[model samples]
Structure formats: C-alpha cells, structure tokens
Target chain A: MSEDFYIVVIAVLLPLTAGMLVAQRNPYHALVIRGIVGAVAALVYALFGAADVALTEALVGTMLSITLYAIAVRSSMSLRLGLLAAAPCDPDEPTPEEPPLAQPLLKALRRALSRHYLRLEIVPYASPEALQFALEKKEIHATCIAVTEALTPATAQSAASAPYHLSVRLPRLLEIVQNGVPPTLASVSLYRSRQMTTANLSDSPDARHNIWENQP
Target chain B: MNGILIAMTLALLIPIYEAWQDEDIWQTMLAFASIATKTSIMILVVSVLRDDWMIGLVGVLILSVGNASLMLLAHVLRRMNEL
Candidate 1:
C-alpha cells in the first residue's frame, strides 16, 4: 500500500510536466521541457519495475526526439530575404556608396524577426531583374531592392524619401515586415506571383508587369 | 525508504520549477541537467529499494548516458547561438 503511494506520487509528474510542455509557446523551451517529461516518465516506468521500458524511454524517447526536434525547429524557423548584390569595388576603386539605410534596415529586420522567433537570412542576387525573378519563382520569401529611379509618379515622392522598397510574396510576411520596419527606412508591399493571380492576368506578360507596377 | 524517496522527489521539483519558469535557454538547460541526474539517481534508489538488479542496471545506464545526451543538446544549442 505504502509503495503504491510513492509510485502514484511519482506518476503524477508525467501529467504535470506534460501540461507544462503544452503550455510552452517557445519551441526550444518546449523541447527542453520535453526532456524533463521524458525523465519523469522513465522514473515512473522504472518505479513500476519496467526496466526495459525505462531504458528505452531514456535512450530513444528523451535523447533522440529532443535532438531531432531541435534540428528541425532550427532549420524551419527562418525568414529568407533576397537582396541586390553590391557592385564590385576595390580599395582604389570609386563606386556609389551603399544606401545609408542599409545597416539600420537589416538591424530592424533582425529585431522584428527575432520577436517571432525567426532568423533573417539574406540572399544576394546580381541584378534587380534577377531579384524579381527569384521572388516570382518563390525562391525567396521577400526581397529588399533600392529604388534606383522612380518608376511612376504615384510612388515617386515616397520612393524618393524611403529609398528602399520591400516586396514580400506572402501576405502574412508582408504584414510582419510592414509592422516590424519603420516606413522611413523602407516601403512594404505584397507581390502576388503568377500562380496566385487570375488566369487572364497570368496569360499576358504586360498584364503581369502591370500588376507588379501597381502594388501599393 | 519511502521518506527518503519522497524527499528526493521534493528536491526534484526544484529544477522542474526552474525549467518551467526560466525563459533563458541556457538556464533551462541547467535545469534539465539537474532533473536528468536527479531522476536517474531516483531510479537507482527505486532499484535498490525493490532489490531489482535489472532496474538497477537500467538506472546505471541512464545515469551515464543521460549526461551524454545533455552534452550533445548543449553543443547543438551553443552552435545555434553562434549562427
């Protein structure tokens, strides 16, 4: 009877830790709590004289799953942003200076992504055309392009002041970057790829270009 | 025997609470290390109480191996921070 009492008490930890695991919002923290849950479960199993079960729980359940989940979470939770590669310059070579907002924009992006527990990875393309193509192909989630010349009178004022325009393919990501970055540093807009637009718009190259030019 | 086990269980609660409440990943890692070792030791105690050699063997194996996994997890976490 007394032995059963202790066993029951130890067994209660399983649900307690499981509850804690369910309550965790952070993936990494949840993984650690999972390890705790595994340890408690092993104790309960061994307390019941299930030696094999306890060993398996310790070996495979705790160690293997935690490591796997950590890697999976690390790899999946990231935002990939495409950038225009800087033109070649040498020590003696005089090239146009990088945009003044470059460093602060990246800092703001990192800060915003970190809030969502996401990492920002910048992929540089050789030309603006290539960057646009990558965004259309969904090779990247978002692209940050410097406005070399104002394309239309509508955006000229904002483009002149902002200097950078961020075109994001995903609507949700557009919202995140919009809220995260200051408007003075960059203007944010959503880019709908051919697949997402109507079939008639997708049929004509000119219509597609018009859609790209029309983004707010 | 029951009293000793109960005491250890109470002690184990300390790190579990720490793991739950702490937000810093490293502090939670420390709590995990503490819980892993304490639970293995508790397993060893239970094995001794029941005079079960099989369970004792499992306990010893977990005591040695659990820390190895912890080290692996810590290394992975450290590299994550570096990147």
Candidate 2:
C-alpha cells in the first residue's frame, strides 16, 4: 500500500476503534489503544514529513479524547451535588428592636431615657475628644468607640478624671446591642464591677471576662 | 455521517458555483472538496461498522477540525506562492 493509503486508513480506523471501546464500557483499555495509535500515527507522519497534521491528530485524537472519556466516566459514577444546591435564597426580614440586652450601652441609655427625656440621642463621634466634651457637658450619657481609640494618650488623660467610662468594645457590645437595642445592664455591670479595665470588653460580662482571660 | 454528507455536498457545490461565476476560486474549492470527500468516506465507514448515532456526531467534530486545518494550510500555501 502507498504511504498516503496507510495514513488515511489509520486516521479513519483509530477513532472508530476508540469510540467502540468506550461504548463497550472499558475506557481504560480504549485509552491505551488510542494512545498507542496516536504515537504510531505521530511517528508515521513525522517520517512522511507531515508534522502539523500529526501533532493535531495526536492531541485531538488521543489526549483530548482520553481525558474527556475519563472525565465522563468519573462524572457518571460520582455526579457533583454542589452545582444542584448552588441557587441563591431570598434575603431575610429585618428584625425589630428589644431592650438594653439588644442595644449598645450608649444607644440603650438613649432609648431607656428617651421616653422620659424627649431629645435623648447617641451619636458616634470620630474624635474621643468630642465624645469627652459631650459627656462632660452632659449632652450624651454614654459613648461607644473602638479599643484603639481608648489607647490614645489624649483620650487616656481626659478619661482619667472625667465621669466618662469606657464601654465594651464595639464587636462584643454589638452582640448585646444588635437589632437597635441598648445594652444598659451589660454596661452597668461592666463599669460597676471594675474588675477588668482593658478595652476588650465583650457584650456579656461572662463573654467580656472570657475575652480578657483568653486574649487571642 | 449526516454532517459529513451535508459538508461534502456543500463542498462539491462550491466548485460548481465558482466555475459558473468564472471565479479564480475553483482551485481552493477543489482542495476543500478533497478533504471533505475523505472525511465523508471515513464517517460512512465508521457509522456502518458501529451501527450507532454517536459515530456520526464525532464525525462532525472531526470533519470540522479537518476541513479547518486544510483550509488554513491552503491559505498559507497561497500566501507563500504569491510572495
């Protein structure tokens, strides 16, 4: 047979054989057969000086087909459940406000006193100096600032003699103050006990102690 | 097999159209016919041997890739010859 005849024959037969082997439920054997055919075809093409055609056949004929068959087999056996459960859910409803346990110390004081005193408010001032001024002027009863703010020299000096008390840290205080309720009991217990003076106070007294004791 | 027959018929018709228009594109059309004929024959043989539909489906993919490569090679050759 002519070199062209042989090349044409192999090209036609290899894929047919591989597809048949796959249909017979033996992809591993098919893969081996396909690989050998691909390598032989590549060698034959190289000898005949048809390098480009050989390369394409080797990739698409053997490698790609084998990989695809492997993936199909694996997928058939163990289909992924992740894709089925990937749909998004509707957003949850907004919760209503409760009391001191649900709100921040500052917000709790504002809400608790707001009924008796009409214009009671809790504003989050960036500068502790402003918060100190408000506290001194009795404009705001309590303030909630970050632990980092309390560490500043000016804040420390001002808070030393002032009637102002360092409320629990924002994250810990958030637990008690969530859903727009003030944490007055937690703050009062925290301030009155004075057992621990660090800025890392938790929303609950127990949680605050846990934070202090386990300073991670 | 169906896709290959369709492509081969199209390939055969292209040369006739080029010949009718007196266009210089008949040679290119002839090259397409050669590759399409070979692919069509291969598809027919595989479809008969297997007695399955998937063989015809795979024949479509193979024919597409084969014809595209042949066209690219012809284009490159034409450019080289022109140069």
Candidate 3:
C-alpha cells in the first residue's frame, strides 16, 4: 500500500489541474493552466512507467499545442477600431492634433476590452468617407468618428450633445461597446449597410452612412 | 524516499494554490513556472526510485525542454501587453 501511495497522489494532480484549467475564464489564463495540466499529466504518465507517453505529452502536448493556440487566440480575440486620422492643423507643420476625447475614449475602450480579454487595434483612415467605407467593406469591426461628421440638419441638435460617435458593424460588438463605453464620451450605434443600397448605387447620398442609433 | 516525494507534493500545492487565487497574469505565470520545474524534478526523483533509465532520460529531457514552453509563452504574453 505504501509503495503505491505516491502514485495515487501524483495521479490525482492531473484532475486537479484540469479542474483549474476548466475553471479559468480568460483564454490566456486557461492556456497557462493547460501548460500546468500537461506537466502534471506527463509526470503521472512517467510515474506509471509509460516513458514514451510521458515524452509525447511533454513535447507535443504542452509545447507545440500551447504555442499554436496562443497564436490563434491572439489573432482572433481582438477588436479592430477604425478612426479618422487627425487632419494637419498647419500646412507647414503637418502635425495632426489627436482628435479631441480620443485619448479618454481609447482608455475606456482598453479597460472594457481588457475585461473581455480582447485587444484593441486602432486603424486610422484619411477621411470619414474612408472610415465608413471600411466598415461597409468589413475591413474594420467598428468605426469611431466625430459626431459632427455624421450630423445632418435634422440630427444636428440631438447628436451635438455627444462629441464622438462609434458605429459598430456586428451586433455583439455593438452591445459590448454600448455597455462598456460611457454615454458622456461617445454615442454608440449599429451601422448595418442596407443590402439593397449596396446593390444599387443610385441610393441617396446619406444612404451609405446610415447610423442606426441604438440608445440604451 | 516516500517521505521526500510526499514533502515535494506538499510543496507543489503552494504554487497551485497561488495560481488558483492570484488575479495578476504574471503572478499566475510565475506559479506555472514553479509548477513546471517542481513536476520535472518530481519526475526525476520517481525515475531514480524505479531505477528506470528510460524514465530518467525522459525526466532530463522534460527538465530541459519544459521551460522552453514557458519562455515562448512569456514572450507572447509580454508582446500582448505592449500592444
């Protein structure tokens, strides 16, 4: 009984680390715990006299799989945000002023995205048209522009309250930005291009930039 | 020999517990590093007890190579934070 006691205890660690892996909420955290699990599992295998199995578990299971999955998770779990490049204030200087409130909004976005284990990637477009075009083309997951850019005579009063406007293409992203971002900083909305509008270019000029206000 | 393995197992629990509760990613990473090293060492001890050359060789390989995964993961994680 004493001879086999250590084996039983070591084998129990396999399931314990696995439970920790499953309990982990963050993908990156889960990946690290998975490395722990693999190590423990290899030890268990080796203890049972399965040296080949242990070797395979340590090399292919822990190292190769974790690296590949890290790449996959890093690439897939990120939010790509397109913004208008700050226009040069002076022709000679050519130094563009960062958009007003861009810093605060970005900070809030980073905080929000971090909670979800998502990275925020900023892509700058030369103009509002380009920003909107990228959204329509699915080039970016979302676009943030000054509210003034999208304002028409009718919405000029109501939209003026918010300096910046964020238009997200995906519904889930819209929800995340809406819930995570504060109302004072930017107004979040869903912008789904009308299927017919894309098919027919003769649609009204503002047809492309339709910003459906999803005010909570 | 059994007493030493038991003691090592007890020591292993410390890092596992640290990993379970710590909020910081780096702290959890530290726990992983500790756990990886400890497990490899435990394997080495087990190999010696059994007098199994194959298991001993496997333990040496793991001791050397297991940490490579940790370093690769750390680089990737550090890059994630910088961006």
Best by TM-score: 3
> DockQ for model 2?
0.02
Q: By DockQ, who's the top model here? A: 3
- State the lDDT of candidate 1 residue by residue for A1-216, as single tens digits: 975677777888999999999999988999999999998898998998888999999999999999998999988888888776564323453332333338999999989988888888766555555566667877789988777732335545556778788878888888889889999999887876654334433454442231222323
lDDT of 2 by residue, A1-216 (tens): 442353454445445434534543233333334443444344344334454565566457645664566445333322010000111222341221121222344455445433332223223332344444434444443454433345346554544543333432224333333333422233221222123333433323332121112322
- Backbone clashes in each candidate structure, one number apiece? 0, 7, 0
RMSD of 3: 6.1
For model 2, state the Cα shift of residue B21 in Å: 30
How many Å off is the CA of A102 in candidate 2?
Answer: 99
Candidate 1: where is the Cα deviation over 4 Å?
A: A89-101, A149-158, A194-216
Error of 3 at A28 (Å): 0.8
Candidate 3: tens digits of C-alpha lDDT, residues A1-216: 987887788888888989989999999989999999999998899888899999999999999999899989998999988877565234444333445546889999888888888999876665566566668788789988777776234334555677888878999888888888898888887886844334343544443442221111
Using alpha carbons, what is the TM-score of model 1?
0.84
Better of 2 and 3 by DockQ: 3
The window of 10 residues in a row where model 3 chain B has the poorest summed lDDT is B45-54
**What DockQ do the predictions score, one after another?**
0.72, 0.02, 0.80
**What TM-score does each model's chain B reach against the true chain B?**
0.96, 0.47, 0.96
